[model samples]
Target: MKSLPETLPDETNALQKMVLDYQSTVDQLQEKLKWYEEQFCLFQHQRFGASSEKCPDQMELFNEAESILDSLKQDDSDLEETISYQRKKPGRKPLSKHIPREVVRYELPEAERVCECGHALHEAGEDKSEQLEIIPAQIKVIEHVQVKYGCREIGIG
Candidate 1:
């Protein structure tokens, strides 16, 4: 039989091996947990956060248009001669007549319609405004059924 001191060394070596194996397993599990956490966070952000990414090309185009407008304004101001140009007047665009409209007539109260002079105010032209409303798209599943016809006949020959 081996002495106690010799056996002690072998037992110590076995214990050290077990400890190393456990430590390695723990490290691998921790690494996998960290990766799963990162993936979860990314998925959550994609689902709940803003969907649009800013386009660099669009930004560049907008900046270029603004610069062109600024340069035109500067040139107009620097010219000593009076430049008479007809500028398009900005006004409310007329709503398409084809679109169905829900006419809401807002009339003043009967008492308020009469002036202090006791003369009834005549109806002037009404002002009209249009607003575009949108309905969100809906998803639906349609089930299709097909009919099959089968012919059964006995052999005559």
Candidate 2:
């Protein structure tokens, strides 16, 4: 049977230093937390300023700061729990895999026209409207070119 080797004094000293380093990181995190809180308050005040009454940019900043503050608070809590109890709470959920819907715009050529059958025929109208359908995530777009003669006799070949 093999006996386990005991920890040397040097190893113990290194471990103690590592713990102290972690403690310093926790202190720095606390300072950052305070700064973020102050920024959040400032953003809120800007959003509700009397001059504008409601600044959309300021409101967006306020919301972003608030969310970051919440995340920092969760991180701080997790850090404290790690230091004292060596355990952490569950963190934020991963992003969803679903693709988001997007609005796509395309300009039809000036030579396009609408036919009696409700189909937009080429070289018929200046203005055209279409309700584009959303393509699936896996689908790809392809474009094709077509040329037609106004008179069939012009294309006898």
Report the number of the highest-TM-score candidate. Answer: 1
Per-prediction TM-score: 0.34, 0.26
Model 1 weakest lDDT span, ten residues long: 148-157
lDDT by candidate, in order shown: 0.62, 0.56
Output the lDDT of residue 75, model 1.
85
Q: Which candidate leads in lDDT?
A: 1
Tens-place lDDT per residue, model 1, 1-157, is 2336545445778878866877899999999999999999999999996566556466678789999999999988877875699888999776556654554456666666554445555554455555644445632222222222222222111
lDDT per residue, candidate 2, 53-104, as tens digits?
A: 3555787887899999999998888564335555667865433335333334
Which whole-number lDDT from 0 to 100 does residue 129 have in model 2? 28
Clashing pairs in model 2, backbone N/Cα/C closer than 3 A: 111-123, 113-125
Residue-pair clashes, model 2: 2
Report the number of clashing residue pairs per model. Answer: 0, 2
